[model samples]
Target: MDDLNAIATLLTKPEPPAEAVTRSRGRLQDRMRGRARRRIGWLLPALTLATAAAAAVAMLVTGVITPAGAPASGREVLLMAAVSAERTPQGSGTYWYVTREMRDMDIPRQESWTTRDGRRWSKGEPGDPPGVVVPDPDPLMLKGAEVSIEDLEKLPADPEALKARLAGLQGRDSAMTASEQRGDPLFSLITLISELPTPPEVRSAAFRALATMPGVESTGAVEGGHELRFPYPDTTWEVKLVVDPETARVTRTNSLSGNDGSVLLSAGFIRVTTGWTDQPPR
Candidate 1:
């Protein structure tokens, strides 16, 4: 029923099983619409990568999670990301496009194009059964306080003022998680940096705010970028964001448990690219 999905192929990869790709598509659908996660068993991963993306996939690798007593390196890493984001040009197009794939899983890749008014179109790996281009109408969940793309664009660019704006918007929803209830502006503003379609200045503000948050640490490098870990109040696990400061994009994110301190891919995704494109969604 859609023509826009026929746009150029987006990713290069060996193909995956058709069944797995179909299932992945449905799960992705649930996420795009702001619905609660359906537990397929194993622990329910943290909500950091939930909206606009899934939790993670790889599991059970041992690591460490310690609060940074003096996080000079950590501060520097985020500050660098802030500078990089400011320098990077923000491009606009007819549709906002994102290409994401489940990490370490055999599921096929997925792509989406969101219209300016928030209508979304998604397609799974090539040659899977044809699926309709459904529009996900739900607004983004800013850890409880709902916001449209337009509202996110209006956020302030100054770090302190941006935190203040999110703080004011929090607590409006009664069903907010325990983390959201605690009123952590650092946590709330981070969604803006990682996945939202905010302006580069807004993202720069978020990175600066994250730099000053207590217990954030630069945990050394990964394959594509270095790992940045930070504590979340009232949660047993700290958050790990694998980011390339030069590009100012989060490549991967997941929770590091207090005990084992492992990075589990079963809970999140590897975001290949998210940006505006003239590419149409079928």
Candidate 2:
């Protein structure tokens, strides 16, 4: 059809007005432009594939894509796990069954030296047993075989009481406070976090606390949200936590920044996909 049109144009010799010739030339230019556009459009996918291949090569050379979806250099594996049970009819209330695999660093058995707290004792040098050090039972265990927002509701609702209870925890004794400046800022900030509320303040107090911690970032939703971050140089030690909007209960919690993930250090939501199914404990 295009060939026929071209032959017809070549054979036709009707006298042409200058304006008509100009119009004919303009139409030919328009048709040629359209064809050029179609040809470019056909190359778009090839161009895109080539661009993607270049980016993949660049990332591979820069070590951005590590083994097993792990973050590249300067980042550490932030493994997390959460368990919730007894889904409510409204589909809004679910009991937080467990948030294990938190960070806890027990200085190597051999590296443990003791402090003179009324008596001199050795924590044992490396390669030696942890010695006669007694283990403090986890309070979370005694709270219940299963924990819920309702259970926390029964506790003293007073923030002061809550602060006192939290302050009494093992690491709290060494916790630095706002008044305890001049010392380690990290320890002081950790103590202050013990007073955090379900939906973080996001304003004066919470904002100020977050500022003191490093690598600490945040995101939120209309109703509720959280912020997980690390205050230290190491990426392995971090905090993860979430809250129940209505009851203000800590619904999800875990951490991975410590040597052994067991301690609740930071509080925030993390990106993950978890499923709920009742299965007997192994």
lDDT, candidate 2, 1-282, per-residue tens = 442223223223334355654544444334334432112111111112222222223223222333432221211111000000011111221221222222233343211111112111222323334554332222221111222223333433233344344334333322223322222333322322232111222111222333334465332211122223444433455554332222223333443212111233433332222222232111
**Candidate 1 structure quality by residue, lDDT tens digits, 71-181:** 125665676566557657778897777666665667666666777787766666344345545454444557555566888788897777887787667444444445556
TM-score of each: 0.64, 0.25
Best by lDDT: 1
lDDT of every predicted structure (CA atoms): 0.56, 0.27
Give residue 263's lDDT in candidate 1 (0 to 100): 21
| Highest TM-score against the true fold, candidate | 1
